[model samples]
Target: MSFPHVTIEGYPRVGANRELKKALEAYWAGKIDEAAFTSTAHSLRIDTYRRLRDLGLTEDYAIPADVAYYDQVLETALTVGVLQAGTLDEEFTLCRGNADTAPLEMTKWFDTNYHYLVPEVADQAFEPNPERILTIVREAADADVKVRPFLVGPVTLLALAKGENPLARLDELVDAYAAVLAALAADGVEWVQVAEPALVADLVPADAELAALAGTAWTKLLNVDNRPNVLITTPYGSLREGLKALADAQPEALHVSLAPSVLAEDPTYVDRVLEAVHPETTLVAGLIDGHNVWAANLRERAEILDKLQAGHPDVAVSTSVSLLHVPHTVTAESNIPVDVAGWLAFADEKITEAVALANRDEDAFARADRAVRTRAESERTRNAEVAARVAKLPEGQVQREPQFEGRKEAQAELGLPKLPTTTIGSFPQTQEIRKARADHRAGTITDAQYTEAMKNEVAEVVKLQEDLGLDVLVHGEPERNDMVQYFSEQMDGFISTDNGWVQSYGSRCVRPPIVIGDVSRPEAMTVEWAKYAQSLTDKPVKGMLTGPVTILAWSFKRDDVPVSVSADQIALALADEVADLEEAGIDIIQIDEPALRELLPLRKDARPEYLDWSIRSFRLVAVDAEPTTQIHTHLCYSEFGEIIDAVAALDADVTSIEAARSKMELLTDLNEGFHSDIGPGVWDIHSPRVPSVDELTELLTAALKHVPAERLWVNPDCGLKTRGYAETNESLKNLVEARDRVVASL
Candidate 1:
């Protein structure tokens, strides 16, 4: 068996229109049995394999053997022996958890917005479970689909874990990987891709140390007896010391990314790559960008492919990363504008494009060139007003006339108590709420009727919060679909989709709005709801808006302009909403920037500029506010130590964070430098379990050791949109009870 010249790192596992999501959720809820769930997952894998073959990737090892019931990391953990679970239900419990147990902690994967379950690396005995991998391989082979297994490499798995140092047992881990590879080889597998993305990341360890470990891991894995050919992949970041280590190991194939997200480099980069790559090894050039949906310039990429092929004896065409980040296909979409649709390529299109590039199909290249040229020349692509407004923006826009102390003094008039309780905005979106939204969308209900239903939901939320004794209230966001999509749908310069759903985590998918032009807010997005909710409550209600950087990070980025400029334009649009909120008498505004830390450039040298623009974009939202208005912001689901200064620089009156699941671990990073009033979440809302009053009190009490009682607020780790009403109600009751206990003790 030989390595395929055209290959993809992975395909979208969740089916088009989220068939897998529905099936998984149904299985979790016990609506579908294990057999049914397995059947759905089996069908998805078969469909993906057939899709690759249909697109001319018929060669052995061309299709990726990556399918996960929940997450790739969780699946890798199971396959490589780090996690030992007995059954399918038990495995799902490891990620989603039972009502009695808390699941694994999850965080952003690399610089991407997708989340992965964090592996817990305690003193558990390591034993390989190759059944899951072998079964999938066997099934695909039985279906006559030759595939390559793509997996999380040992070094990366160890580096990404949360407990005791797993790298100390690298030999044991890599040996376990060897056994799995041997099993696959026995099952007729020809190639396996071991993803070591951490090698290119900015880890706590020095590059030299990680590279040494990487070299050791690869040397053993590649040399394993009776095993498939090893393909070592380092996605997202540009190659540094990681490349040298892999090149020295002389892997069967070395995959390098040319994604636009990687830092632009010198024209001599191809020469350097040729010099570093092993002479006899296959070099898989990831010429297609997988992180975005925009079309690739085939003419330009073809020339680079020519140069690379001239240098290496064996060169394959592939995407820079997995198509899991994108939707299933553009063919399923019908709502996109004609020119924009012509200039777009989803996961399926990307696979065909890879094969076309590998075969040097000139007609495909010409069609791509024409579409690219048309997009470049389109009148709708640029807006003079947007450019001029951003250009003429005043200097020191992020600087506030009033610091936190002055703003805190002004906010004192609201008489919020120490450890004032609040949610992170959004209550449980009940079935009725969902139905109302769906009916409104389907035009079954009049606009006025829908408004009445939403107002009723808001009123119920306010009264419910007051009864629960929460000091601050939120509108529960029943009218909105997604935090980012709600704003994007109302604003200019973005396109909404009917079937574009990319998996954010397990069964949690987000349709990222496509940014096609200059951004502006033609109208207020949340002011009416905020105003109406405030009218129903004497306590201050938060006027919630997703922050500018988060809005940009969550959406497909606009490559035509720098991200900083796009973020600024979005900030200005949100600034208008902020002003409207103030005019409508909703003083406490929470602008959520949960994706801020996730979007930091992987290279340390490139971070300051990103932080400068991202922080400035966030600060720009509340810069024009009066001193009496309290501006709060939130950041979550990431390690924030690298950007703690930027978090402080947000100049928010209060800052809430996702700290509950990690048990206030983020406080260790804050120390005395973070001066904003802090809310370390008391409940892990992502999980279904409702915590006891005692548990919330202990977390709040621990947080008090890090910050003063006066500066602390109690809240959930994030919005409760995905949670059920029963759990949300009980959780808030326990949270408020815990806050009262802590306040009385103080």
Candidate 2:
């Protein structure tokens, strides 16, 4: 039992200043050498440990050396020797894919917004690769910053594997893990944090198979010779019946989330967790919320810590989930209002809270109590008009009127072609576009200058789309910063940060807006841009907007109110924008709900409530649109099988999804239950490799079997914002050519 009083499963790997993001992007672009990239990672690793140590976390397993060079799951896959990549270039290809090999499929890690590279174990071998994690540990050791090494647990890695049933490979995988453990032990490591999130990710009342699987995996791991002390962290809790399996093998310590959302469904949750753990095993109470930025209710957390620590043999305190979900520090954000910043706690601040609770610091408790209380009591958190609108929201199932069948004919009146070609809202965000945006925000460029530059870019994009012979087009979104952040900036009751960058997926960072109070649109977001883009071309240009559910999902939402209420408030704001877009003569509007499936409750019992509110919030956005308006919604990168019915229920005239990466696998599920017009993406926008005309044609042809050629829209997997113009131009041309050939053949 060597775990520290305050420890985390992992720290934020993206540097406080986003050093890792810059380094990785530079490496990917070939703008930097391997030595330069390695140096940057070395610095980031040292910086994380030093920063955590300075912020009241003790040395020796207190700071987990979770240096996610790209992604933690990818790191774990390498450690277990499952990913099978040989070189740095090959490893990156496993993440981003090349001309031949498609990148591993990525989905949201559990219910959080962060996406993890799913392990491809269908036809892969398992062996130990200790060099990756060990190298990082040694790097930290050289800096005299002792830290714990972290890994995804054997059971979890197998549980989340794609393409094949990996249960049979458990014994083999455990052997590989054992080798890694032995290597760490020989390297003078004292402890390791193994994340078994699978145990709790989809916890049920009782799952005999899962329990047995976990029981066997833990038994093998703990029994391995020369193993380091194991701290098995079942983060993002709701362990429920899964606790018995974990308790069977008394680990050095166990980490569990006490956040209500995870630990719900039982009044005896705390008691059950305490009871389940062996008397010798330390109990690490994950009482502080790690997913959101709100300051911990130290008073309430102290009460729980007091119960856990009072005479308990070895008790510590920590966060309910990894701090990776949150930004590094609110202190880095000089632009955020002082009053709002006071209520928030980023990764380092959260760790400080954990240390305080562990040490039973009363002064810290008093300070946190005041901050938490002030947020509750503040008038700034509430708005009368926003409250009135939320109250007036229509009751019942809230389905939109004149469903897809009725609107299909009205939409056909516009006479769009078969296999209509379009992008998923944005074109490549060039350096010029980024600079203009930055300059405008920095006050170096006047409003007129920025607007003119954006209009020029939009016109260029429209011309490019026209040249590519796309049936529909986009304004290219040069004026926007992020899909969610752009909308949050113009709305009331949201705090947009200047430097609060958290990793969304590999080197792609987003400053998630903080939803502070009741949300309302001050004027219209994206209306003038839509109107101007439409004015440039007679062809329909999509009036792009991020949907309400997505905006709420992406933001650090208010803890005081239910998240559903926040979604509705945002829906109302976006509804106003949708109306304005429609009034501006932009009929082909698309409100992207890409995070729709991201926020689905992990538990089966809890999903109905989430689906009801989330789907209604989406419908409310487009419910007021005209029949011929053709409101299109795009969802991407998620496992949409779970929400196919809900996706159809959304009742958008058309729904485009991330189908390319999954090779139209969703079409099978969609064909069974879905009724609306569908777009199964033909191009994988995340990768640098462009799909050939034949590849796109093949994908479009496959899609036509499930969805009619007329209903099947051809597009890329997601927005082209992260891509470059050269790749984007070539890809669009191939995509349109693919569509033309398919249409001609039909």
Candidate 3:
């Protein structure tokens, strides 16, 4: 069969909404049988396919099985390949023996937080499971929807797989994957998309051997008897190599991302790939930004698509990346003014974009073009007001009453114990905690009841720390759904969605609130919780606040205003909270800015302005505190090697950062320039598996190599909210044991 002219190019069908999540939860809980679960899951796929089918879209099928236990499709690939280390298998195997058994660890997919399950190919007997793909195909078929199943391409899978030398088995693995493709073909799914996003990675795959491997994978997959059309999709980054092989192998179609920055390029990459491709090959052009809320430049994108089509008139339009990067729907953003809302395009709106571009009808194109115009106008209005407000900030708000030295003395007098043990400001949020919040949201429990529940958790956390012999205590942010979302909900300038869930990695979804106005604290945000928790123990309590840069980075901010303005507004609000906490006698505060590094300007030239605003915003919040207040900050998923100086510039009294998994590669950078006290996390928190006391002792020993033992604190890589109680408790016990060992050795 000929490849259809109508192809839909986006993400999977599974949504992070309440209904879908409940069904999956029930399935996991064994409350529903496989048949019942599969039925519910299939309905979602059918609904997605039907929606796109009604609009005449086809290239990609809305398959639910592509979504997995962990939201990462690559993780699904790993599971299919049976790539588990023996130890991991053993740990998960005895889950009933140890209720705190951590699940498989997932690491960042390249530099992005989109995590992929760490594939442990300890042996060579790994086999592909056709049932995974077949399940999706069968579901689509039952729904009467013609679907092309999607898989993370062999190259990408190999890139994400874990081993001493993952690249070593690339050829053999690609061959195995080709065989899997053949199987999918025989199953009557004619079309398949092998996503090789690793093509965009820094390692250029232009070598002859590399090209040969890519060619081998494509030709073998495409050569399957009665195979469906094969489409190679690569997005998020440009293909630096393999273009010639890709064109030469000549799958049914070729897809390339058309981001604003990429579109503005010399167009040479597109032209070369297009020119080199077989004349019969179709081109899928990405015409809309996926990761941001900025309205699509319809005229500009349409013009680019038109230009690309001038060469290959069979060009099809799609989003630059998955709509998963965008919010689920705009309808949930109730607080945004209707005029402003009109300027936005959520996932549903972007689907409309795909259909509009497929028709190439100028009239339909004009409506999108008008959306951009209205968006631009709205932005102009917003920027003018925001800029004026920023220009008039009271000068004192940006400066401290007393400088670092003066404040440091007061903090020391508070007599915090040396080598303090503290958490990253959250304890395990159990099923009970989640239910309480759910009940509150559903009105089954009152706000007061929810507060009491959260307070009880905080009180328990305080008691636990005292029992555990920790120095600094945290309020265990159980009341918050997400670090950024919680603050945004309370602040004056943000709007949250009930169903705006976007996958953070897999089943873990974060509904980052949308910041819409000048940020201001309506009242003291954390004083009550901080004070209550402090009252529970004589131990100094750390008041937790998400830093300005993080709140700006994590939330969907108004592009109409410069990020600096938005950040400053957030900083000002946080500044008020910091003052309130200090007045309420909270002696320690930790401002977490985990997303700061993620938000660094992609271009090197643009970084100074970003850093200036980012650092200023952090300082604006912290400078108001007396140095005696013991200001601490936490950074995550960031390699501080390049910007170590910038990190130091923030002058936080102490900072905790991810170090366990990073292998202390960043320690030397800190040793050279960092002046503040530091806590290089002694253990990896992302993994559910607990580290042994010996493992932590080694980690702490290595940490002391770069940082002085006296200046060091101990903590986990991140908050423990996602972890179960057993893992958290056991891990902390090991951490304390390791510390004691280190102390004894000294």
Among these predictions, the greatest lDDT belongs to 1
Model 1: CA > 4 A from native: 99-101, 263-269, 395-397, 415-418, 639-642, 687-698, 724-746
Q: What's the lDDT for all of these models?
A: 0.87, 0.84, 0.71
- The C-alpha TM-scores of every prediction are 0.95, 0.93, 0.82
Please give the ranking of all candidate structures by lDDT, highest first, separated by commas.
1, 2, 3
Model 2 scores worst on lDDT over the 10 consecutive residues at 200-209
**In candidate 2, which residue pairs clash?**
none
Instruction: Estimate, for each residue in 260-330, the C-alpha lDDT of model 2 and write its tens digit.
Output: 55554445778787778887888888888898889988888777776676646788888889999899888
Angstrom error of the Cα, residue 340, model 3: value is: 4.2
Q: Between which residue pairs do clashes occur in model 1?
A: none
Whole-model lDDT, model 1: 0.87
Worst 10 residues of 3 by lDDT: 88-97
lDDT of 2: 0.84
Better of 1 and 2 by lDDT: 1
